[model samples]
Target: MEKKTNAEVQVNMHEEMRRAFSLLSGKWKLEIMWLLNQRLYRFGELRKEIPGITQHMLTAQLRELEADGLVLRTVFAEVPPRVEYEITQKARGLGPTMEALTAWWSEYGQSVPEKPSMRGRKAKAASSKLG
Candidate 1:
């Protein structure tokens, strides 16, 4: 096997991280996935559940998520067509990550007094660092 340089290994790691994050990159992608993880939501229901998300933005985000295979969009045949959204198995795979974030936030984030303070952030990061 060929020996890879440190820079090459770092680049590979960054690429992997980028590709992984890209699937969930967006203001509402994670939130949408988290909500859908619980139950199927019709389009309007989703819009109402998430505050400040416009209809156009929700549609666009849902389309992007569906394209990424993280969300499933189902349309029912009826007098009035109904569309529902839910998280896919691929997205359910992220449940552990979501839970980890929730746990971490519940423990550390709530303690932060206010926003725009790096003192608390740096202290927390240093304390949380593990070898």
Candidate 2:
């Protein structure tokens, strides 16, 4: 086997990074995945959980995730019918990435200076949508 040239390796890395970023490019997709990691949720619940997210955007994001195989959508057959979305095993594999992000935020938060003028702390962003 032969090693690839540095230029070829760099190109491959760039392409790989682009592909990964493209998958999570949407504003709320990462939030949705993080929420689903905690527990499964229905459509209505998801909408209520994600602040500033319109029903139209939520629906579109969920469908996109489902198509990408990151979100698992299950629909029950009944009179009214029920649908729920959960993170698939593939999505669950993102746990380390999420944990690292949380860790980084913790360190970053600590680096901020405390000032009386700052007032109250910032609020948590709305929980990610489940479905």
**Candidate number of the best lDDT:** 2
Best by TM-score: 1
Candidate 1's residue-wise lDDT over 45-71, tens digit each? 998888777788889999999998988
Candidate 1 — which residues are off by over 4 angstroms? 1-11, 113-131
TM-scores of all predicted structures: 0.75, 0.74
The C-alpha stretches of model 2 lying farther than 4 A from their native spots are: 1-11, 110-131
| Candidate 2, backbone clash total | 0
RMSD of 1: 13.8
In the range 12-117, model 2's lDDT, one tens digit per residue, is 8778899888888897898898899889999889877877787788999999999998999999997799999999999899889988998998989788877653
**What are the C-alpha RMSDs, in order, of all predicted structures?**
13.8, 9.2
